[model samples]
Target chain A: MSKRVALEASHACCEAVRMADTDVVAAYPITPQTHVPERLAEMVADGELDAEYIPVESEHSAMSACCGASAVGARAFTTTAGVGLELMHEVVYIASSMRYPIVMVICNRALSAPLSVWCDHSDVMSVRDTGWIQVFCQNNQEAFDMTLWAFRVGEDPKVLFPVMVHFDGFTLSHVTEAMFLPEQEEVDRFLPKKRQYQFALDPDKPMTHGAFGPPDMYTESKISQEVAFRKSKELIIQGWKEFGKIFGRYYYPVEPYRAEGAKTMLLMMGSLNETAKLVVDRKREKGESVGLINLRLWRPFPFEELRQAVKDAETIVVFDRCISFGGPGGPVFSEVRSALYGMERMPKVVGFVGGLGGRDVPIKDIEYAFDRGREVAEKGSEEIFETVGVRGKVEGIREPKGVYLPAK
Target chain B: MATKARKTKAAVKKLRTASEVTWRDMEVGGILTDAGSAALRRTGDWRSERPILDKEKCNKCGLCWLYCPDAAVDACEDGYYEVNLYSCKGCGICAEICPKEAITMIEEEEE
Candidate 1:
């Protein structure tokens, strides 16, 4: 039996980590990700959870320590947000390429420049190509459930890649929500005590990991990694199915919310999906054909599921929390567009970048997005993307500002 | 202990050169299961210069053997040090470290 309790999303993640029986917790303190490791440290100190908690000075060392622990066949875990993730950018790739199976919780926060410790997808988007199995959590319950699922899927003999469970900072991480916490015995049954890491660092069977590969071997090595990564999707779905059987809460790569027979759809990821769902409900009540598609899995992207979900919709308004600077719209929008390309019948993808740096996305902004998206789909706009609720006017400068010419 | 040594030797024997192996042949995470597998990789082809030994001027101090980074220098039965061309990378460390100045680095003619 599972107990229902109100917990801050960060603490909920800690509880899941505790139940997972992680061997090592190595992380640096970064907001709003600080509460997760902080609570885990207290649990370790109280002897409630027996694990080695290494309070590293930097996020780079934190991830490096996780690599070491995972290499030695330890179930390692870590948490970071925004700039802390950028600080450990290089090691993040190392953790995946080495197939460490280290689980991480990213409290998604905006990047620096303006310097805000708030919720956004900027941090998570930067590490999109790091080769980790990435997933987004819509609420505290999903956050807790996915952390456990991460360990199970990642540590499976078939899929040894690292996993990153991302939730919006402050919005999901700091907010208190009622979630069901499963019993220890139930979690143990789901994720067995024995871990099968074939290439673990053991003295009895000596082996070399992370060997230098010259040009002759580098491409083949990457091809092997890619093959394994693509194959992990099957096990990921299996893990979720098994978890649902035990926990009664099922999850999917691309989840639909009242998307049946709708002409216009709203696509979103992370905590904002709940708000979008509410908007979808209100639109449906008004006899408007609106639906919501929540992208749960980010890496090993749910391309087939996403296409299937939006196949009937005439237009898809992709609301991205992070911008791609000068590139085509947002990162999610560009990928979604590319995924829908070459199809016989494809919907118009209207991208909007908003809710940046913890800015509140009011119900009216979402409503405007739907209206604007419909209008844009009917009559095309010259702009690549439009910012939602931004208060500014721009003057166009078509020519170069400064130029230097060599003497003739 | 004997079985373990034999198992490692068997793994080493089964190991294929980089050009011969495909992605499917690679171990999980590209881990090399056999220990001391580096000894099987011949790095001697990287050499542009070869080390030559002057036997009469050599003091047989074993400095070349000690200083050779690749362990390419070997001691003969007659106490003379000879460079093993199969493993030498032409780093010239043996020539640089010899006190008697009996070792010389000569540029190799293109094959």
Candidate 2:
């Protein structure tokens, strides 16, 4: 038989991870995330699961242990946040380049200067280029669902890269939601036994993994990697489609919240989009035309899908939680702008960077985003601008609004 | 609750111990150093051990590369062992087999 229980989002994610049947889990303890591995430890102790749990010293060693275990043909799992993610940064690249299917959970938190362990995209944004397929979970249910799916998607032979599931720190990590725990047998049916890993070990079969690729072959290797990433989007969709078939839930690359009409729109990722959705709802109730685009896929960025979503809107507002610093707006915001660059009827995009280090971006402030959008659509504005949050000069910056994208 | 756990554990322990004919063999079980080179010299596990001359030591003899089982020693910009950490596996074949004796199979420093 199976069971259902009320647990925090972190615990819900762990429950699915428990059901996913990892063979080996190597992780070091870090906050807001400690509960996750702690529960797994209890599961192992009770003999509820047969697995090897290796607890190492630091995040680097944690990932090092993960690489070592994954190398020898075991399904590995780990979780971390903020500086823990930073410490594992070097090995993150190795995991992806080597194409070992290690899955991790990043309970999103802000990096510290004076020390903060609160919700922010700064940590996840910093490591986006490490080439791991990253996914944002809107709530605890998605957190639980995506954690199981990440393993399935990541371990697919076509997409053998590691994956990171990001959920807002303290906010979602501590926030509880009613999640439907699937039967373990269903998960077993969904994710079958892994193909025997051909890692380097057997004397009979000598093999080389992660040997330095020379310049002559390195370019082609990267092209193949990009091709794999393109292949991953289809794999991600297939994983989701299969998941929806079993669990009665569906997901899209760019989950359009309410962009049916509305001349103006807001594009954002993570839970902030939830806040943006409520703002759009209240505005719609007042007979206003405003919508939201909650992007689910960041890397293997769904550029073509996003452009098609926004082509009809007259004005676009992108609320970025992490800034690109010295570049055109935030990283995702810049990508969205470039994706629309060639479109003949691209919306006048206004980029706003806010919610750094877990600052509040009230729904009222989101209204200001629409107000700015109205200014652009009405005045034919070219001011590419940013929003100043509750914190000012000392802790916040309101970037100027204008078009920095190359002309369409 | 015990469920005869002790007996199984002791049996497992005994089985594990019995499998190892030599404790020393178990210690060196996973770590292979010189065996890599001997294996590559598939010609009856016997090849003329050639000495590699570290460029700084050699008068540009080009000797070992000429008399090598394989063209394994590659010259880099600065003098350093381009030991293909892959195939070479620190076999000491290049170093022990080096005429200069500059190549010694010191145990690889644990990274």
Candidate 3:
């Protein structure tokens, strides 16, 4: 029997890492993400978990160490938040390109200006093109569950790319929740000892890694990497199915909630999906033709599944916690729109950017967004992207005297 | 028992271009089977100026051998060291480092 315990979600993730029998945990603690490494350190100190717990100097070194560890066939893991993710941005690209199966849990936090350490999807969006498989979690249970699943999927021989498991900082990271922590024996059975890399760094077999490819070979190198990543989606589905069979909890790349026979659907990722689901339920109760599409998989972008999820809908309102600045819409919205671009009966996609810098995107704001999206769809508006929950109208906000603005 | 693995030397004699590369040359995780494949590339082709050795004036002090970055200077059957045009990049480091003034940089004749 599995143990049922109430624990902080961050600790739950740490427990998952322990139960997964991760060989190395190298990370520098950032707020909301600190509890994970902190508990891992305690577990290592108490001799409960036998692993190399490297307290790295910075996020860059943390990721670099993980790259090194994973390259040597160790089941490496790490956790970071906000600026830490940005600091390790360069290594993030290398890790995926080199095909290191390092599992990372990012307690997704808002990026800084007026620095805020709170929940948002901004950090992960910044590295959206890093080629690592990214997954967002809705609650503590999912965070814990995905931590285990990440190692299984990432370490699969067919898919050797790194994986990022994103859970909302503060919201899911700090909140205590009751969930069943799987037994060590079950977890061991589910995830056998990590198999050795076919071309691992070994003294006996000398080989070079991360070599410079000239112009002639660079294109093929990139094509090969992308083909491997795209093909990993099949292995990801397979891995999830295998996990479901053992654990009795199923998950999908894009999960639909009351989306069938609905005209307008709300799309969201991370913990915000829970909030959107509530509004979907409320709207359904009042006979409103509204539903929700929760994006569980963020990378390999789930292009086909996303299109299939909203195929029946007339309007799709995508809630983005991070804006794309000069682009057509938020990151999620841009990807969603691009995914549905060539369809014969494409849904009117509305991009709504809110909950930035950790601001609470209340249930009312989401309801308003759905209604406004429906109105925009009915009107056939050319402009479909807008910001929500931003304070007081900006009629007279000006750039500094020295800063020149380009004439629009 | 840490012996280094070596591929057939005859295969390293000629430089192979990207078009000559086949899928069989590709490895699972970018592994380089032949560790120092740079030797397979005739970097002497990149040389604008070649180093001409005056064997009579050469003292065989071995300074040129020490200074050659690519280790292109091979010790002859006699005491003198000769440049192997197959691998020499003609960096002029050997000419600059030769105390006996036995090496001269001249325009490389293209085939």
Q: Each prediction's Cα lDDT score?
A: 0.89, 0.72, 0.85
The model with the greater lDDT, 1 or 2, is: 1
Per-residue lDDT tens digits for candidate 2, residues A318-402, read 8877766667767777878888997988888778777877787788889987886677557753334465474553322335556
- What CA RMSD would you report for each candidate? 4.2, 13.3, 4.2
Runs off by more than 4 Å, candidate 3: A380-384, A394-408, B1-15, B22-25, B41-57, B76-90, B106-111
TM-scores of the models, in the order given: 0.92, 0.76, 0.90
Ranking of predictions according to DockQ: 1, 3, 2
- Per-candidate interface DockQ score: 0.71, 0.03, 0.44
lDDT of 3 by residue, A1-408 (tens): 778889877998998888888899999999979999999999999988889999899999999999999888899999999999999999999899889999999999988877989878889989999999999999998998999999999988889989999999998899998888887887888897765678778888776888767666666677778888999999999988988888888999999999999999999899988988889899999999998999999998888998888899999998899867667778898899899999989998888888987899889999989998888778855443666787774232222247676989
**Best-fitting candidate, measured by TM-score?**
1
Error of 1 at B41 (Å): 1.4
lDDT (Cα, 0-100) at A32 in candidate 3: 78
The order by descending lDDT is 1, 3, 2
Stretches of candidate 1 off by over 4 Å are A393-408, B1-15, B54-59, B75-87, B108-111
- After TM-score superposition, the amount by which residue A27's alpha carbon in candidate 3 deviates from its true location, in angstroms, is 0.7
Which digits, one per residue and each the tens of the lDDT, describe model 1 over residues B31-55? 8889877666545766899999999
Q: Which tens-of-lDDT digit does each residue in A1-408 have in candidate 1?
A: 999999988999999889998999999999999999999999999998889999999999999999999999999999999999999999999999999999999999999989999998999889999999999999999999999999999999999999999999999999999999999999998997856787889999998988978677788889999989988999999999999999999999999999999999999899989999889999999999999999999999988889999999999999999988768889999999999997789999999889999999989999989999999899987678866877784222123367889979
